[model samples]
Target: MTPPVASLWRRLLDWWPRIARILTLAVSIVVVVLLVKLGRGIDWREVFLAARGISGPTLWAAGALALSGYAAYSGIDYLARRFLNHAQTIWKTLAIAAASYAFNVNFGVLLGSVGVRLRLYRTLGLRHAATAGVVLFGSVTNWLGYCWMGGIFFFGAVPRTLAAWGIRPEATRAAGAVLLLVACAYMFLCATAARRRWTFRGHPLAFPSVWMALAQSGLAVVSWNIVALILYLLLERQVSYPDVLGITLLSSVAALVAHVPGGLGVTEVVFVDALSGQLGAHEVLGAVLMYRVLYQWVPLCVALPGYLAVELRARHASCGAGGHDLPEEPYER
Candidate 1:
């Protein structure tokens, strides 16, 4: 039997995750409410009309871009699993990832992402310790990709933005250098982790081959840039590839911090700040708001039905004595 203090500690530790989840939910709700109140100028009728005006071809192209991004993400997972020698089915991987993204779009990204990975590995009959390693590797690799993209954009684009804001060129260069160093440091750490087989909580994490990581990273950047271009096209009635890339990178970096659901307020603010010079204030607001409705919410609305359909079918396939079986615990993975 455990001592009373030890038992108390254990109980707290057991409930800690649920407590964290509840706090996240509370924060998400509050932030969303505040953002909605602040950005309340959104004209629902105008948004509706604007959405209707989106041409079928344009919608299709946007969806295609999104699908391409999903595929790249799934591919990254597959490669990671392969590298780890986990040997899970590709369809299982894809479904789990799709569920993850869908959950991320609805719930907060961190919880949804981890939850999806937990379930995916559990369902695939992977050990909890191994699953933990896979999740850690995948996260670190994806973030390395993010840092690389952000670093390139910082060096190539941010100095210009800063210079345009009347900062001295030398100052801008210095700032860019700092950003570059940070990004490089992050990449170095990730590389070290991958090469050394870093462990988190005693679970050894392994990354895919370097070439595979880089290829997936490249695809992720391109896929995101394409989505940004679509939004730019919709808003400005034109697309600037450079602007799209820069804004995409900026928004991605910002999203990591914002922690809002789907990076809601944070992404819009970053896009507006990045594009204000080219598009002006009102247009930036309008464009970002409009982009959110279509590129963010609308797709979620559409995809959710498909997700539900898939889930229901899956449920039906799993026979039970009386009712459906409950999902196993995360620790049971």
Candidate 2:
């Protein structure tokens, strides 16, 4: 090859990953724009009115469900600890889980969530590698649940859902089959090779036992259902539970794939598009707004104070110990 041609080819190879990332980001932005335009005709006044009309009983029910959902989220940490055979206290696990999730749900996962978890777990005397294992285990737990429940719902209820969106039944069934296959493959791996470990970046990681994997998947499904119930309650019980579950599952996948902060614009777009038939645009928007406030904002508010307290105690302990290092702040990264 000529020198210039060889140089150009090497440059293209070097830049390929970055180019692909840029293209993905551009596409995500366009999707958000189109979805926003689709819902632009919604009446803000009606949305506010719908929000205000939610009864006290309904609000209470939603709040209770939110609590249950978060409790299940905390259980993810417990399950991770059990899988690792770590002896951390229940209070510590719950505290770290709650605070980390509160941050992650609003911010993107890698952007903030894992950092918060690492900091808190370190404060509780977990080493860096062990902390990473916990984070990995928790993440795997979430995806396992997503795949298992998502596969079931997509195969059963969501084909009808796609039909509403004008998608062909055959295509929808194929997608569901793919999801189920992936879930089954993971379960098979756990059953056959649970004791195998892999190393990444100098850290060794092991898969959970078959029973533990099933437990993790089950906890994740229960958590997801509770969250969906919260949304259904916020929507004043107008939409059926199965529809809400399917929509929520698809919306979450969209948000994750889009890589948007908190899946902010992406989630709104998916929700409006999916639920527009059962509820008016304004009503759907209102329910989403309420769900965000109750499910995301409120938990974050409660968690921040707890985080602050942890930091203050760590600082105080560090000062008294004369030369001890303190846990890094969540914003350091």
Candidate 3:
């Protein structure tokens, strides 16, 4: 590439994250202001009563689902740690992941997964290379499951909610099929190319074992579906599970791509837009609020103190810039 062109590309890459964050923050603020204006007409008493009317058994089910989903979320990092061959204890790794994930759910990746995980992992003596590996692997693991699950949902059942938007079911099914193909391709490559090294732009590519790849996809699907079931139960099963799961998968991708902190305003908007066909806007918002309380707010309340300890440890860091605890060739095959 030409010098000017290459420099422009480099600059764009550098500035992209900052630009995305600013745009996401602005969108979130706009959504909040709109909600506040609309809140004037909302019947809080009714909403509260509706939530209160839920059976105790259903509430217990939601709590169990939340805990299970969280455990599965932490398992993504567990696999990453194992993949990196880090010596951190399983409990320590899960704790860090759980805390960071809580922050990620409420805050953005910058503060939660990227920032919090970076600080906590460093204090445990991991170097930059190993830390990056964990982050990358965790991401890959989550996406692998999302694609397959999304594909299945899209192909197996057309979302009645999306039909209101004039989207063709056939088109949705085709897109889902594509996702399935991509998912299958990844597994095929892993099974055929494990331990093989291929380099791009001077950095080597690594593939985990097929079993590890399967584990990643399975864990992610489990985490995502449990969360969806929680929302479904919150909505009193007004919508079909397939419809809810499909929308949930789409929202997960949107939240990640938009980098909307905690997905604060983003998730509600998406849920209302798609789910309003089956449930009233007030009902949709109510269910989302309940979901937020369980999935984001409660965990965030706990993660705050845990992250505080992480900050304290960061002040007296035990980590090294040099690959001290890392293997000589740290990108494990």
RMSD of each: 8.1, 6.1, 5.4
Please tell me which model should have the higher lDDT, number 1 or number 2.
2
**Backbone atom clashes (below 3 Å) for every candidate:** 0, 0, 1
The candidate 3 region of ten consecutive residues with least summed lDDT is 324-333
- Give the TM-score comparing model 1 with the true structure, all chains together: 0.68
Off by over 4 Å in 2: 1-23, 35-39, 194-205, 326-333
Q: For candidate 1, what is the lDDT? A: 0.60
Candidate 1 least-lDDT 10 residues? 324-333
- Please give the ranking of all candidate structures by TM-score, highest first, separated by commas: 2, 3, 1
Best by TM-score: 2
Give per-residue CA lDDT, model 2, range 28-108, as digits (tens).
887768676965676789988888788899888888888888889999999877876665677888889988988888887
Candidate achieving higher TM-score, 2 or 3: 2
- Residue pairs with backbone atoms closer than 3 Å in model 1 (clashes): none
Please give, for residues 1-333, the per-residue lDDT of candidate 3 as tens digits: 799998999899999989988877776565566567656766877767767776778788898899898999999999998787876678888998998889888888788778888777776656777777888888788778878898888877778776876889999899889989988988987887755666667987777878989999999999889989999999888888888887788777667666668776667777877875577667777787888888889988998988787666655442543434333323343
Candidate 3: segments with Cα more than 4 A from true spot: 1-41, 313-333
